[model samples]
Target: MADDSDLPQVVNRPGGATVGEQFRELLEARELIGFLAVRDLKSRYKQTVFGLAWAVLQPLIGAAVFLVLMTRVVGVDTDPVPYLLYVFVGFVAWTYFQASFTSASEVFTRNTDLITKVYFARLASPIAALVPGLVSVVVGLAVLVPMLLAYQRSPGWPIVTLPLWLLALFVATLGPALMASALLVRYRDLRQVVGLGLQTMLFVTPVVYDASGIEGGVRWLYYANPLAGVLAGLRWSTIAAAGPPTEAALSLGVAVVLVAVGMFVFRRFERTFADVI
Candidate 1:
């Protein structure tokens, strides 16, 4: 209410570029992320009779069911590799990515207290959900050892390359997780869409059937799925599948694009999170 003569003109606020700053903030908040992850893991089993065994059970059941459906019922040829073993390997990897990314997408909406108060890496929530799944995947891999022994499958030199395969998987999976998490802040409908999309993707990705089952221009569609390379690379590394390198490269390239697009889109809207979310 100062007199017009004495009043100063109003000025616009400078829009902030906080992506870098936020990343640093996230680094600092790493411990919080770990705690949240551990808490989630604990809460997951709190009421259950079996506890963490439930994690092992899910993929095992899925693998067994798919193995029966694809091999026994459908009579599909799995090539030099046993169909069940091969599909099991791919299923574990794909399940991890799907679970991690889907949970990541819902992070912001899932934890209101964490987002609203006490500044921490906003990205940590989704990253945290990834932990139990990672633990489950590791244990799941261990369980596969006895199965491998039972099947007379031998671990090969290619197994040494698993770390590289996993790195690609992580980056590829994380892109969608982050992208979905950020968008859910504004569009809750995406939550259900992600669930349905993952289901559709599973049928399309050649998890149960060999990539060879697909024909012509449609074959490229499987390669085009970002996870095709991940599933293929995982199978190649673990089971000696020797899938196409060019197609794997294409999958990695698509993953890179998804991550780049996710980061750009997430950053652009991230500032509005505190206000809208």
Candidate 2:
């Protein structure tokens, strides 16, 4: 029998990993990634009476509240489509982005012990954090289908573009998530700021209202929010609403740039995460 003590140890040198090397490491750690994702899913639903129902319930409840407040009370217009269906689609996409961003932002701080003790790729944490939210979004969609059917509406041919729209959403959120997670290692107060920012962003986005309502210079500023384009594209894809294709395309381009910059920033700072955490 071979002695365990005879095994050679691996050493990781500081600033030794290039972007390619890091991605290779991430690929090699795919099993760990899946495990962490499953762990997150189990931990989130563990001991909860509702379990996965919470995913569907949350958006359903929100849609109900907004349906009353926007349609019945305030009378916000969602012409050509039922108000409930319109807002529900927005909620589905928004909920996914919000949850993914929030989870990714706290990936490092939440798993301080694991990062400090383990030798896995640091990127895996944020990447794995995305899985639970993706699951929730899919579950939310199951609830959405019945609502659409009840309203006598269908997503139409545009629905084929859904995968592309989802990819854009992921890219848009990943940039911010990477930046936030990197900063969180050194600044704990950022968690609160991130929460507040997401709340503020909800109103600014076209989640409850139409982007077409904002005209002139103000409209340009509104489209500046990367999520604006993502939500608009999603709404167009799912409900066939009159979303601004040109603006969505431009914003998606911006999101790609943000992803590049964020990756640079994350990789630059990742070497220091072990010490900071």
Candidate 3:
């Protein structure tokens, strides 16, 4: 046999990575992704007194606040459905998007040590960050179901489309999350910018107010926000509210585009992550 030392060795550069290869790598590393997700979930609530109950509590508290401010104080019209039901639905959907995006944006920086030491797909980190929020969404929905029953309301056939709206929400959130995380590796200050931006987004997303409240050019402007469609579609699906279906469909298209652009940006910048971060 030839000497082992005489054999040639090949090395691949991270910079030359393609989306297909990265996606395949992510698929191959699914078990590790699941482990990271579970680790994050456990770590998040490890010492907390309420544990997972915090997930249910957060949306409940937000719904309560919006119920008071929107119904009692501001007198926003929810029409057929009670303001409580409408606002609660909004809170549940918004909470998931908010929590998932926030965690994903920090996935890279928060796990710098792991990224530097491991040879796994970096996309796993952001994808894993989505798990806790998804768990929370389930918890929140459990709470919502009882409230819907208490209100003597049923979601009707439109509820069947709930999964589609959720997928759109995920795409909308993932795009921004990936873009932010990629940029954040180079500019640490983006963390605060993201926080402030999310706060601003909450107001524009129709969480507490109905999309119909705005008209003229302003309504179209609001419709332009991808999240506006998600919240509209979610409300339409769950509470049978007259959500702007056309606007929401357009927003879904926007979300798909955002996902493509986000992946492109992420793939372009990911090669430098290990070196710069």
lDDT of each: 0.78, 0.82, 0.83
**What does candidate 3's lDDT look like per residue over 1-277, in tens digits?**
5687877543477465666777888898899889999998999899789998999899899999988887788898889878888888788888988889988988889879876887788888888887778788778877888888898888889888888887777788888888888889888998899989999999888888777767677766677788999888888888778855566677777788887888888888888888899
Give all TM-scores, in the order shown: 0.88, 0.91, 0.91
lDDT of 1 by residue, 32-132 (tens): 88998888788878978978777677778888998888777888887888887787877788778888887778778877666678555677777787777
Q: Where does the lowest 10-residue lDDT sum fall in candidate 1?
A: 8-17
Residues forming the 10-long window of minimal summed lDDT in candidate 2: 8-17
Candidate 2 lDDT over residue span 1-277, tens digit each: 4787878545568675877788888898999889999999998999689999989888878889999999888989889878887788788878888888888888888878877887788888887888788888778877877877787778888888888887888888888888888888888988889889999989888888877767677666677788889888787777768755466666787788888888888888888888888
After superposition, candidate 3 runs with Cα above 4 Å error = 1-11
Could you tell me the lDDT of residue 174 within candidate 2? Answer: 84
Answer with 2 or 3, whichever has the higher TM-score: 3
Candidate 1 residue spans exceeding 4 A from truth: 1-14, 213-218
What's the distance in Å from true for residue 62, model 2? Answer: 1.0
Ranking by TM-score: 3, 2, 1
Error of 2 at 132 (Å): 1.4
